[model samples]
Target chain A: MSDPILEVKNLKKYFRVTNGVLKAVDNVNLSIQRGETFGLVGESGCGKSTLGRTIMRLYNTTEGQVLFNGENVHQLKGSRLKQFNRDMQMVFQDPYASLNPRMTVGDIIAEGIDIHRLSSGVKRRERVSELLQTVGLPEEHASRFPHEFSGGQRQRIGIARALAINPQFIVADEPVSALDVSVQAQVINLFKRLQEENGLTYLFISHDLAMVKHIADRVGVMYLGSLTEVAQSHELYRNPLHPYTVALLSAIPIPDPEVERKRERIILEGDVPSPINPPPGCRFFARCPKAMPQCQVDTPRWIEVETDHYVACHLYK
Target chain B: MENILEVKDLKVSFHTYAGEVQAVRGVSFDLKKGEVLAIVGESGCGKSVTSQTIMRLIPSPPSIIKEGSILFDKKIDLVQLTLKEMESIRGSEIGMIFQDPMTSLNPTMTIGKQITEGLVRHQGLSKEKAQKEAIELLSLVGIPRPETRIKQYPHEFSGGMRQRVMIAISLACRPKLLIADEPTTALDVTIQAQIIDLLKDLQEKIGSSIIIITHNLGVVADIAQRVVVMYAGKIVEQGTVDDIFYRAQHPYTWGLLHSILRLDDDEKSELVPIEGMPPDLLAPPQGCAFAARCPHAMNICLNEDPQTQIIQDEHSMACWLMDKRMRTEIR
Candidate 1:
């Protein structure tokens, strides 16, 4: 509707392995409106995390531009880069490995604040406590080490750390995958509440489709370093255009026993092809049930099949 | 159908440095022959502990089976079996698979050797015969190029394939019971579906009773005929798959069901998360363990643990809300 808070144009990130260059994120494009949650979903090694990190400038882009608020994120340096860092943050997947075990929870949360020189001494302490409270942790929890807290509590601390710098955009990469089901619900709710309160834009990346559907205004499905489908959460789930998207949706086991038993699942055959020197055609051609002879040779063009829904598949064309 | 496995009043505890942690408190359930039973719970809820205890996998020095009997084939109390005798039954009579395939599988050995080792030791098959059997097992689990893949090490296989190899190894001896502890948790949703389907297909062919231990209700619904809902080291609810999903009684079970972001549901509906964490295993609460987090926890629920109330022929739950007296009081 309004100007996109974050925009990606022909983004690519490649790692030169011994064999070949691993195209982790290839020719990707996306735009996230202010206060919108853009969910990125795919299996492991599907470049969801890579795309998130590339957008956050955690990795140097192999190609293309990340425009944050009309400013090229790749070109920003020194004070401007520092300002970008303050405005954007990331909540990592693993709470156990992400947080330093040696650091106190308060110190960990305030690391961003300290780096940005936002507060000092008593004020810093108060800010840390307030952030801890914001993420549903008590003030006393700030004194405890990461090991003292449970997995769920540790995740809350991670969220608090991300929110410390008051970032307008946060890239949460598989933030709740490690958490238990009930605890995951709590964290998701917290994310929703924080987004509402702060008017934040989130690049919420996860392999869990159901979770992404719950939190994301729009959802994007990645398959082996390329986005296969992107659409409104409800629209995508209801009528998945890409064969990969349809299979992925069908594969997710519903908790309802009756539906689960009755449903005809499209269980995709074969593992995701290696990203290093990936196949020339559609990445999902190997396993796609509806793949044709042309699909094996011709790379499908990304097209807007519906009013807002987009898909990259020969079938859509 | 006769129950293949029956766990009665099973109580297990770990002797920690801090204190004795009661992991499983008077848990009991029965698994019919050729049926799939799923034990669903969050971490520290003792679902894994119960399954491990059934397989006699927990280390005994720190972990102790305090009271109860795990009767296999209605005669053998697995708890009473000596280590020597249990070893005989471990793989041949009951096979177990863990979550992480990389760790469970040996790095040095070929996939063929790993699968055949059990066949040779337990079934007394010749090296050639065992190797042939291993290839067949691999093919059975849907691993392509079973002959060539069998020679390769675990590292050569993909995550999904490695898991298939794990399944192949587990089913080599053709045990009467197969215990899969979060078999697909580490896998992607598509791979997870494939694995579940493979397990179901293999179950039909082998006809071994399955006990799938997982925290995911979705996975439970996909593969299991019966479901057991555990909370804070206790079996809070047990019923048929339909009963557990549609007619759940325990507040904990309801909370668990409600908390999950279901694909079929409207995306806008706010998830009702169970407030507060699972009780500390070291010093669990005196009353119902889930009472603290349960939305409908009553005074009695906070004060005393409720006894298992049989709802129907095969459905049961342990909750004050399920009690006839509580229902009458509410009316």
Candidate 2:
């Protein structure tokens, strides 16, 4: 789709430990079109967060490339890399730990501005104030510290900071997971408005399938460090092909009792295998209900099952 | 069906530095014998606090049951129970399963040890007897190879398995009432279903009442016979599963139902999210906590609180719109 805004090719991040190299992120490939929200979902420790951070260049990639705007960001150095940093930013998962306690909300959002040398003196202050307003926070909040605001407000501050650099791409890693559900709505709506206003491409990383369905144009399912499925939001939710995706979707609790009672659940067995030593063949084989013998031996390559819908599972193979 | 636990006019508050955080304004509900009662609310609505309070688990000094009586066994007022009395009731008379199983289970101890520790303390059984019972508990929760798995530590078990172990431990005493606070929120959908079904089957087998505290409505459909919708620490709606699902009254309840993002309803619902944020617990609204966000909010809603009105025989709602008195009769 017009070469996609960002393309991930065999992106692998391995960590050497007492055990052999832990393939925390092994051979994951995904792409996000311009102004589209690509949701990356999996249970905790599935390397979804690592994949997001690596894509954002927060963690240096050990293998593969993150092609941003058709340029391999890892290859860049010095000033060019600094400029690239301004083009992309990250919204961390934990609002409590992500914001600097020492810095004021204004200073936190202004840090990127200061680094990019985007403005001078009062102009930077005005820009920060503008950003705060844009994110639906009061201008007076600029003087307040991160500790003063609620978890949701702090996340908004983080979002404002990401937008400070006038970024084309943003990796929001579980931005609402830490916030109260009431405030989660506020922040999610703010994200939608900002997306429409800024036309930003987002790799929205979350384990919450319902939230993903609400925001994302396309959804990508990750298993142990591999991309198992990717499809348009409606299609994936309606007809989930991958066993992992089906299991994940069945897990989301609906708020209505009638619908909740009627919906049959896909109960996955066993825990996600250790990323340090992911299972041979399909990473989902151990837990997948539809897993075949071949699924335990030959890694299922991701293939297009339908128009714009991809699944990597022996069921389809 | 006999009522196992009846919480009446329960008021809980935390004495924060800011002020007394009125967490549960006055929440009340009942869990019938062998039935499931789901307490649904957004965070800070006091669903968790209400459950924890019944278990006498709310941290004191800051947290206090300012006013109300939590009647368990249809007679015992939990607030009146002493520390020693509450300890006896915790595992044997009333079992509680928390949100995160990994943190709930002792990391250093083997699953067997952790499960048996409670039995040794509460049941006053011998170590050998408790160890034997531990295997049965594990198997009861549907964990495979209970013999080998019990010897492993919490880290060795998967999230779902660890949760199952926690459930087994909770069910060890075979308490008459089980309090599970967001038991499956941390688990994935498939694992969540398995846990829900296991709980349902356990409730049927043990004939113990289940009080599930959660924000997800989907879970209530599977387990709950009656649903209690809480808002800003007060019971906004209470009814049977059918009553609340098909004939939901309160605007807050409506907001919650509509907000649930369904895979099928995506095409039907035109991105209509609930308009406003939850009221600040520090300073809840004077009238209705949700009045600020309610689209149908009238003059009385902003100034005077509306008492709950019976919508059906067993269903009720707390909203100005539901108040027949608020409606004027014109000549």
Question: DockQ of each candidate's interface versus the true one?
Answer: 0.88, 0.49
Superposition error at A220 for model 2 (Å): 1.5
C-alpha RMSD of candidate 2 = 2.2
Which docking category, incorrect, acceptable, medium or high, applies to candidate 1? Answer: high
Across residues A161-228, which tens digit of lDDT does each residue of candidate 2 receive? 99998999999999998765656777888888899999998999998888888899999988888888
Error of 1 at B113 (Å): 0.9
Score residue A36 of candidate 1 by CA lDDT: 95
**lDDT for each residue of candidate 1 in B1-331, tens digit (9 for 90 to 100):** 9999999999999998999999999999999999999999999889999999988889988999999999999999999999899999988999998999878999999999999999999999999999999989999999898999989998999999999999888899999999999999999999999999999999999999999999888888889999998888899999999999999888888888889988988638998888888999898898999888877877888889999989999999998887887789889
N/CA/C clash count, model 2: 3
Measured with C-alpha atoms, the lDDT of residue A280 in candidate 2 is 77
Give a tens-digit lDDT track for model 1, residues A1-317.
Answer: 57699999999999999999999999898889999999999999999999998898889999999999999998999999999999999999999999999999999999999988999999999999899889988899889899998888999999999999999999999999999988999999999999999999999999999999999999999999999999999999999899898889999999888888799988889999899998798888899889899999998988898988999999876
User: For residues B259-311, could you state the per-residue lDDT of candidate 2 as single tens digits?
Assistant: 66665566634444566567778888889888888998888889988887888
Candidate 2 Cα outliers beyond 4 Å, as residue runs: B268-270, B273-285, B328-331
Segments of candidate 1 deviating more than 4 angstroms: none
The TM-score values for the models, in the order shown, are: 0.98, 0.95
Q: Candidate 2 versus the native: TM-score?
A: 0.95
